[model samples]
Target: MLPVAAQQNLPVATAQTQNIKRIPLQRFEVPGTAYETVIGIAEIGPNVSIGRHTHPGPESGYVIEGGFELLVEGEPPRMLKAGESYKISPHTIHDAKTGADGAKVIATYVVEKGQPLAAAVK
Candidate 1:
């Protein structure tokens, strides 16, 4: 395990740092069919409606700059604010939209090797 000091000094990694480009949500996906973690900063648009999708594995995220409303299948949508964190389990259906002023969220996705980061579902 990394020492507490080392962990504290570590910087947050983003999708760009992982070599993934900032594509539109509609075009979001792991390029080249290679499954690997891609951490990125996302600016959640206000009142944005994300189509239904499923994560191939787990997706962990935190609100960094703004607030949002998150909805996971079988649960009611909930509001999340800055500094809040949540995790989407493997194969879980979910979607999210920004709050009134929009939000910036840092997301880290742990996907299965060779699987797409998100698979569109209905």
Candidate 2:
């Protein structure tokens, strides 16, 4: 058996840093409707592009770190840095690319029941 002092000196397990971390914050179902509100955070890696995608509902997000280049259908691309925010309409095609130092964002969405949070745009 290991001594108590020896056990106390052992390395502790810790969560490793990752390129991206999606943390769900909250979810609320609309009363008597097929809709729900979801909130979460997205941590992106440096120089990463999330790729073109669409949501089944409206989405709003605020930049928390570094910056992002956002491209949405029918509009010119825009750069959003920390403390900045954006809103995306339902079914609007868009893509988010992170800057050199990477980025973190807090996002919220009002979506339909059973639909995916995001769908890739072909």
Candidate 3:
């Protein structure tokens, strides 16, 4: 186990961390495919920033409350407000930073089974 101080600085979605709560809702295998679908809710505290990362496949999400700035490599940042939805292609590096009100989002990912759900990008 990591020391309390180190744990406190972990990446937003890594194991667990301050300012962000990731709740895994479900994971199921896709019929006739080698991929699986994962659903979860990400609650980000005010001013929290989730660094760039990527999944083995695609990730789609809906803003459930408040909003954030979605930054993807080579693209302009997009502000996703409540009630909006967005999708990122496989392995596309991206990150999100919440505004003062923070944000809550439900995300769905279609990824290869047995692979890490997310990987931080340099």
TM-score of each: 0.68, 0.82, 0.86
Q: Give the CA lDDT, 0 to 100, for residue 83 in model 1.
A: 92
lDDT of 1 by residue, 1-83 (tens): 01121222222233212321132222234678645565666664555555566777788888877687888999889888999
Cα deviation at 22, candidate 2, in Å, is: 0.8
What is the alpha-carbon lDDT of model 2 when measured against the actual structure?
0.74
Candidate 3: give the clashing pairs: none
- CA lDDT, every model vs. true structure: 0.61, 0.74, 0.77
Task: Judge candidate 1 at residue 43 and give its lDDT.
Answer: 61
Ranking of candidates on lDDT, top first: 3, 2, 1
Candidate 1, residue 46: how far the Cα is off, in Å? 1.8
lDDT tens digits by residue: candidate 3, 1-122: 11121223224555325677667677789999999887878788888778777777888999999999999888999999999999999988888889999999988888787777777777
Candidate 2 local lDDT, 1-122, one digit each (tens): 01121222112122212456667677889899999888878777787777677778898999988998999989999999999999999989888778789888988888887666776665
lDDT of 2 at 95: 82
The 10 consecutive residues of candidate 1 with the worst lDDT sum are 1-10
TM-score of 3: 0.86
Which structure among the candidates has the greatest TM-score?
3
Q: Model 1 lDDT vs. the true structure? A: 0.61
